[model samples]
Target: MKGGNMGNMMKQMQKMQKKMMAAQEELHEMSFESSAGGGMVTVVANGKKEITDVQIKEDVVDPDDVEMLQDLILTATNDVIKQIDDKTNETMGQFTQGMNMPGMF
Candidate 1:
């Protein structure tokens, strides 16, 4: 009886794993955008935490202050990465709750 119960539990776990994979795949197609320096720089990233785009306003660039432009870009990129991390956690939390499966995520 114990063996039979274990088999059933394994099957249920497999089903949940499949569901989580599907959700992750769907998330890969979703995009999140973040900006910094008053929107002078903007970044777009996918759920996979891959950066897809970076946009810089021309007015933000000054010939004498290239470092300022670089700083803005860096800030925007970091902000986008943070947004991606937050979003991934929130999305995956739905499946992780109540399951203490170590290393599952």
Candidate 2:
């Protein structure tokens, strides 16, 4: 490629990088929620896969069934994290599609 064309491509890549960063910031500000055990347990996670909140229905808590409760919580947490992962892939995949560059991230 000519020097001018290469420069233009670099500029475009930089612009896209900026946009991707902004989109990532937006994602970080967003939250994902998921529930398990028929809404008995719910968990919220940020785009970075950090748990933000957890909620358990009062009726779901049972001293005799602590294991069940734990399972529900785990399921909900995993689901919420998966949601964030999926959204991140969907959002960032747009910028990465058809690009063979490795180690750029």
Candidates' RMSD to native = 1.8, 1.5
lDDT per residue for candidate 2 within 20-90, as digits (tens), equals 99999999999899999999999988888889889999999999999999999999998888888888889
lDDT of 2 at 68: 97
Q: How many steric clashes between backbone atoms does each model show?
A: 0, 0
Q: Which ten residues in a row have the lowest lDDT in candidate 1?
A: 83-92
Off by over 4 Å in 1: 101-104
lDDT for position 60 in model 2:
90
Lowest-scoring 10 consecutive residues by lDDT in candidate 2? Answer: 96-105
- Model 2, CA-based lDDT: 0.90
